[model samples]
Target: MRMPTRILLGCDFSSAPTKRKNIVVAVGARQAEDAVRLSALHRFSSLDDWSAWLAAQSAWVGGFDLPFGLPRELVETLHWPGQWAALMAHYGQLERSEIRRQFSGFCASRPAGGKFAHRATDGPAGSSPSMKWVNPPVAWMLHAGVPRLLAIGAHFPAHQPIPERTPPRIALEAYPGLLARQLIGRTSYKSDEAGRQTIERRQAREQMLTALLEGRTELGLKLDIDTAQANALVEDGSGDALDAVLCLVQAAWALRHQDTPGPGYGLPPDIDPVEGWILCAKRP
Candidate 1:
């Protein structure tokens, strides 16, 4: 059994995951000289299955495409538990409908454009607000993700105020969009809409794969994938697969900095645990 020295996982999360809208994961292993191999791709039909896989991996450091925290302003306004631990516990007890209702009410009380309170990390990561319950529904992703990490006793770097520890497994918030923009600058490479999956998107994936393999991005790591795997990655125009790879790259980037001060995987100095920063996201 080859226990990987470093595991890079890119998670394309879905709050209401089904067979069609399954959680997409790209798993990679770090080799010598910061080279990574796309070892596997996984899909989860439900959250229980995903949680089990996470629990079984007792030795890995990875990145997940889910917000780790909610906005401080929203927490305060709703009078939910203020601290991270208490807040997560409180949140874990709520069903989806309640979450939608609470989040919708919060938006209703505010003016348009300012309906959702922003996390400091949202600007840099280009992520949907953690409080948003519709559209991308990132709020639900946080709801589904954070508690599982806590249950599995995984370490969350920059996910909270508690000092980061090098545990059996470590997890960090990741946003593939950040890495994609860095590579393809304003070029659209993926789409869920079948009609929107064009040759241009495939070409963009080709460029992205080339950049990753050549060590051109901020990850400072090279990817080792054969021609067949490369074809699979490029052909999946849903972008879920590529997004997972981007997140994996981000994980690799953060792991290199895990031993530094705060051991936060290159997370910024001013990160708020209640509104955590995305690993390697560029601040505006």
Candidate 2:
């Protein structure tokens, strides 16, 4: 029997609807060569618009760069109902500014250095708090991204809302760093911001691709790159090639558990199933 082609998606997410810092969705399919081949790249104006698109996923394996839940500590401290449904209900009642104020107050009450106590998995996963406003502000991404996934009844770890008559939607919380670190060992990649670009960084990217194709990383996924693709991943400053690779890792993970408990595509063992994963550097 022929295997069904897996539709794969990678997202560079932002919570707010703005001209800058908007969310980018990269769609592709896993080729017989075991590489993720591009289909389309979309930029959405708002979470609602993005959700509308996600509602169409019947054959997709998605990797989103957003945290799925608030820290248990944060949720409990705020006294805003612990269950996912109740918490979302309460959160939905408040405005964005109000939510920011509450979180800011919580930080103010804590010691300077210990202001934010994150989950054990957060550091390794390279994710920002769903509430953090600065430096990879992922809180907004969750607010913007999760609800859409929920509305579409996408299968995620913490928020499992079932959409009636919808096709099976498989979405994963992905961390791009998981695969990047495996190949590059915590080095920087192409930055969209112009101020951070450098020649040495460009060289590092090439070395990273070579290492990935040579299977030198700890990840079990082997890269199949020809001369042109390798150059695209390494020399092109867009980072599109690497992002697609991240989607491939997510696809591999999803395929492994497509028929098992929680559909085998749930968060990793170390991750709190409630908190979910932001699928970064994954091993196939």
Query: Which candidate number maximizes lDDT?
Result: 1
lDDT of each: 0.82, 0.64
Clashes of each: 0, 12
Q: Distance from true position, residue 263, model 2, in Å?
A: 6.2
Q: State TM-scores per candidate.
A: 0.92, 0.79
RMSD of each: 2.4, 4.2
CA shift of 114, model 1, Å: 1.1
**Which prediction has the highest TM-score against the true structure?**
1
Question: How do the residues 1-284 of candidate 2 rate in per-residue lDDT, one tens digit apiece?
Answer: 44345577877666775655456676766545344455566777777777777776656678777777777788889887777766765766677788889889889999988777475467766655666856766666666677777667676643554334324567777776667766777778787666665777788788877675565754344555467656656664656446656655566555545544432554454445445555532322
State the lDDT at 134 in candidate 2. 64
Per-residue lDDT of 1-284 in model 1, one digit per residue for the tens? 55445567778888778987788888887787588778998999999998899788757778889888889999998899877778889998899899888888988999878999999888877878888877887888888888887998887767555443357688888888888887889799988889999999899999998998898887788888888889988999988888888888787777777765653678876667777788887766
- Extract clashing residue pairs from model 1: none
Sequence-dependent TM-score of model 2: 0.79
> Candidate 2: where are CA atoms >4 Å away?
1-6, 17-22, 31-40, 43-49, 158-167, 223-241, 259-263, 266-273, 280-284
Q: Name the weakest run of 10 consecutive residues (lDDT summed) in model 2.
A: 158-167
